[model samples]
Target: MSTSGRSRAAGPDETPAIGRPRDANRDVAILDATLLLLTEVGYDQLSMESIAARAGVAKTTIYRRYRDKVALVAAAVEYRSQSSPPAVGPGGLRGNLLTLVQWLAEQIAEQEIGLLGALFAGMRSDPGLAAEMRRILRRDEAAMTDQPLREAVKRGERLAPHAAELFAEVAPAVIVHRIVVAGETCDERFVEHLVDDILLPLLRGHPNKPARTERGTGSKGTRS
Candidate 1:
């Protein structure tokens, strides 16, 4: 709700003007309404009229800012991301990763399953919406991984060459799979296991065993 000092993704025609400044309150109202509707209904069912009604603003007011539904939804997604950024806690890589994954798990768990399903459906059906969401998600994922990895470097930790990319892939995939796909609880124990057992070994490039070479073909392989 508090958008002070936060930079939002620009609306379609949201250029600066010399006229009376746009009301920040109205922007907040509109964005909040959009997210609420997204959770309640979905991208396919959501409309400018519904958002306008929920926000208590004219339909024209919504269109005047955003070019279309995709643009509006994209802006809303960006706003939500900017509003609730990842909370990087104090400590080294392990501590920070645990904190980050726990936060991510909590956020994912808070979302309604229906909303998640709707988003998945929408993304599959709508190219424009999928593209917009992907762009926003990639940026967020980078932000989530960059800080902890940078700090780990400062601590003289020997990380794998692609540590950030690896973390970005492994942690979220496991968490989302546990909650959304497997319908399992992503509790504290699970988070700690993910960080200690899987992620830490991976980032530090600690292989479980040395590669074994086949005698005939001379092909090397490691156990999964």
Candidate 2:
């Protein structure tokens, strides 16, 4: 009964022989409701019945489209993030890094820290959810960092051989550390300082610097 792998736009309309056509609007409603509930109730407290009530749909509709709560939550997160991705970084490594860092700060500030805490807990508790979240975040991180770093190296910039991994993680890692651990605000000033002080140095450092032993240690730096 799971429609998990079906295309987002491919509803029951595609299969006339099936029961009543699936409403794309209802799909949006469900996702929107799920996201709202996630923010308001936290992942552990969120339930399909609650989402159904918020969305004005039956629990069966939710189950028909998603395999479980984890799938539903993952879909909702993806739905929202894909709709409003951080703007693509501009030219130059500095500019690109600043852009990414600033955007992350803005998003974290806008959503507030509590929601992020809930996300962190949810990801830690559920393997399936964690994997899906990591996959999307890694894709976005690569999109932001890879081309810019490559271009910087081509532009006569002296970058470490592992700059791609190390430098790319700077902004997101520091931002999260500050917000979650240090209890600091992630603002424009914070982002600028991060880009200027930490990221640039790492990128421009010698390749001989000690590297992190674990491959996944810093992957998906941000919790997107």
Candidate 3:
């Protein structure tokens, strides 16, 4: 009448062996709270105590998920960049790239002054945070860049030899110029100039794809 191998109740100490289900809600809460704090005070100012208070979780929870402030900040940036759309489409390659670049610009502009100041300050104070920032930028941004290049090339449009790297720096350049030098914000016209005046012309001259095919429909760069 007794169950030999089939136990209905799991032992308390055996939970680890069974591996209790991870709470998706808790993970999301932690990530959301981290991003909120990053946007509010940035990498330099965020702390475990503040994050726990903001997330309404305990310090142990924060520590369990992340090692320190650097890990937390990295997670936050990773979450935001991941959540954002890689591209907005239906307009074809040019339109898609344009839309995506505009989106990138807006995202950067949203955190313009605060981001610059905080990370710059953090680099001087915390080496781990500095390294984390670099990793997040490199890894997360490369995600969107690779696909855009392929789509552009497939449409008979030439992708610049270093399109990904070039595009990565473009949005931030305008932000730096505006917030640091010109003391202003970038508008749609500026983004258009970067895409039309700069990025497009260079790609056309590349050996793979060459031509000024407006809107990227009729040209069909060899169709991958």
Question: What digit string (tens of lDDT, one per residue) describes model 2 on residues 1-224?
Answer: 01112225322222342767778898999988887888888988989999999999999888888878887876776565532333435456666766766766655545546656677789898887788778666666666566777777778788866776785466667776787688788765566566655677677783343222211343333322
Select the stronger candidate by lDDT from 1 and 3: 1
lDDT of 2: 0.66
lDDT string for model 1 (87-166, tens) is 55665777787688887777767666766676677798899989977876677767778888888888898988898888
Ranking by lDDT: 1, 2, 3
lDDT of every predicted structure (CA atoms): 0.73, 0.66, 0.60
Best-fitting candidate, measured by TM-score? 1
TM-scores of the candidates are 0.77, 0.72, 0.65
- Name every residue pair that clashes in candidate 3: 155-221, 156-221
Regions of candidate 2 where Cα sits further than 4 Å from its true position: 1-21, 83-91, 177-189, 206-224
Maximum-lDDT candidate: 1
**Mind giving the per-residue lDDT tens digits that candidate 3 earns over 1-224?**
00012111211122242356756677677777776776678666788888888878889866766666776665555544434545535566667667766666666655546645666777778888778667666765576566767776777765557777776666567556764677665566565555655556654444333334563454333311
lDDT of 3 at 45: 71
